[model samples]
Target: MNFVLKTILEEVRIRVFWILICFSFTWFTCYWFSEEFIFLLAKPFLTLPYLDSSFICTQLTEALSTYVTTSLISCFYFLFPFLSYQIWCFLMPSCYEEQRKKYNKLFYLSGFCFFLFFFVTFIWIVPNVWHFLYKLSTTSTNLLIIKLQPKIFDYIMLTVRILFISSICSQVPVLVICLLESKGVKTFIKNRRFFIVFSLFTAALFTPPDIWCQIVVCLPIYLIIELTIFYALIIQVYKRQLAL
Candidate 1:
């Protein structure tokens, strides 16, 4: 009886120790994630000359908390696919093996492409866009803007929103594949003119109202659309051959 009780107590201690260890690691990771990556990311916005400093919150903690929260979300950004994979693993036994295999790459590529696309948007696209909008919009009449002061929370929120949206938009190929694969949306190969119009419309909708903004956004999408059509056509041909 004494031996059994001692064994049980040891087991509980081991389990608790491991749980605490795992939790400590994750907590430390969240801290480093917020501090290193997020703080660096916020550097550009923090140094921005135009961002008015007048929009001050009475609570000092408000700004710090906002920055921390923004960073925390960003830290978790890369975890989406990991979480998805975990879910996939959980559901794998219940799913048809072949079907699971087929969609596995789709699930993985989505998170990766999001990073790539958003990165492009942020590094190349957004800077140019910010410059253009800042320069062009403030012309003469509606200009002389007395340093527009934005709240720290609002700024962080806005940045996250735009970045996330653009990141998702970067997954145009994945979306195209889904439409072609699942839904019966026919590939728009024949109508180059219609493709042009449709592409422009989408760009205009997503981008700011400026013509330059419209053009810049549309051109890349248009290219992606073309590439998608090419690959889609190849797949269709392959499928048809298989059918015959």
Candidate 2:
């Protein structure tokens, strides 16, 4: 028992040390281009009717704070794959061949899906939603003079929120695949109604308290679930053919 406990402790310590080193290295490397990343995040706001190309910093430390936070986010973004690989390596020794393949597939699928939705959110959803909100805010107020002067910090945080939520949502297909493999596809089919309800609840938790936003987040997840089911069926058919 003592030997097992010591091994676990040593494994944890190594992981922590390497994680910190990876994060530190990534942070510095990402900090170099953090400004350019921030500029891209802020681009949607620039084209708004009353908003200018420039952003405003109200507090003396706001710029510093934004830069540090943005740099940290970018560092983690780049470090995610490495972190996942480290975790896989640590856990792989205990897994059987089948489990290892499943997890390996999961690793690649997660990275691909995450970045896929990240770009989709940034390139399409964020800008379109911002445009809609701009029109809604301006029209609803019925004001003769209206202006949108979003703070730099608030905008950055908003961008982070959208990116984080989209990345999480993008993992639905992976989650579905894992469930199909472990619990069997029939289980998901049987509980389809429950999953639909759960998806809505999930969308509510992730998105702002607005119906449209919830729908926007939930629709892609539902589509991914459908696609995963189709893929699973195809795989099962192929397996049966191989057996015969």
Candidate 3:
């Protein structure tokens, strides 16, 4: 009982320590990234012809809360991978060494992919969406002048939400690959044309009704499909060699 308690305490300590480490790293990264985040967010507004946006000061604390919340969210964005890694490590003892290697690589690679997707969205996709939406929205605004003076908190929260959701969803290819390995799916080469059509349709469904938006999203989906087919081929080759 004592030994088990000691092990539990040790594990708890490790988890706490790693979490704090992740928090600190995240804190510094947020400041470093804040300017870039702000810049990307502001780009969509730049294309607006009307230079009118004013913050409604509800209370003294509102502005402060907005800044604090945004900063903390930024921190959490950088920390998520570290936190995920820490959790992986904590739970790793029961896993086989082979699984450890595979999962560790997958987790780290996933983090890298997450950052890449966010970076790309911040640089291009979101700005295009925002700009397109804003322009599209202002078509009939001659009477009421329906401009967006979006609250800082709401704006930042929305930005974070989209990026986080997109990032999570971008792991679909990885999930598909894993499923293929586990016999849940077979090689899809024969259905390449169908997959392409289906992916484009998905792009159209998910994005606003715009050619550019659909293409921007669909391109990645198609690329993922191509990658999946290639990997499935490789797996088949390895299996054939084993059978021989």
Candidate 4:
């Protein structure tokens, strides 16, 4: 038994080491092109009307830090598919045949949801939020003029934070399904209202303080929750039929 456990641990360590090595290589490659990555990230900000197409760096190290951050984020974005495959490989050894098939489908669905929401955030949410904030900056009284001069480090960090939040939000359906399968659908049904409220609260918390932005984030989450519930119900009915 001890030998078996040791072998499993050794395998896990080897896989993890390889994953880290790949991640480091990707990170350095991204750092080499960090400027281009930053430009891509700042596209929405740059497209705003009546704004300077440059970001401010208050401190000497700020620019380098921002570049590093950008490179790290780009590395993760580029490596997500590879990372997902690694995860599947890591888990496949322990799962039963039936469970392995289910997990295979789940991983694919999860990857799709992850990239879908990622692009949605990049294409829609980020632009709208930046535009909204820029408009707020345009509001000036007679004596005071507010210009939207975003800091280099701050902008990249916020953008990355929003992307990370959206990525986590994208996993809700998979998480809900896992919970339903493990704890039984009746438990989820009983707490459905709370979950809905929590989802709305989470959307409000993560998004900018604009109602439109909140709605944009909330709508996908709501749709996915409902769809997950429907999927769970179908699975439940199918199981019942099989039993009969």
Q: lDDT of each structure? A: 0.64, 0.84, 0.69, 0.86
TM-score of 4: 0.84
Q: Runs in model 1 with CA error above 4 Å?
A: 1-38, 44-61, 136-145, 148-151, 184-230, 238-244
TM-score of each: 0.60, 0.86, 0.66, 0.84
Cα shift from native, residue 102, model 3 (Å)? 1.6
lDDT score, residue 25, model 3? Answer: 73
In model 3, which runs have C-alpha deviations exceeding 4 angstroms? 1-5, 21-40, 47-61, 92-94, 140-144, 187-230, 237-244
lDDT of 3 at 184: 34
Q: Report the Cα lDDT for residue 73, model 2.
A: 92
Candidate 4 global CA lDDT score: 0.86
Give a tens-digit lDDT track for model 1, residues 1-244: 9997897677657655655565456545766666465554444454545644234555869867875676567645655555565556555666787878767877767777877887776676555544554455344565465344446566556566557657646677787777667754463454457768877887777655779767866787778867887898888889899999
CA lDDT, candidate 1, residue 168: 47
TM-score of 3: 0.66
Cα error, residue 106 of model 3, in Å, equals 1.3
Per-residue alpha-carbon lDDT of model 2 for 1-244, expressed as tens digits?
9999999889989998999998998899778878887887888777666634467889999988898899989888889888988888889999999888878889888988888898999888888877876775454455565656678998899878888888888888888988887889888888888778867988899778989989987887787788899899899999999999
Whose lDDT is higher: candidate 1's or candidate 3's?
3
lDDT by residue (125-155, candidate 3, tens digit) is: 7676666766665657466676665666566
Better of 1 and 4 by lDDT: 4
Cα lDDT tens digits for candidate 4, 1-244? 9999999889889988988999999999999999999998889899877547578889999989988889988998888888778878878988899999999888888988898998999999899878887888775687888777889788888888789878978999999988888888889888889777977897888877989878877877877888899888998899899999
Predicted model with the maximum TM-score: 2
The pairs that clash in candidate 1 are: none
Runs of candidate 4 exceeding 4 Å displacement: 140-143, 193-223, 234-244
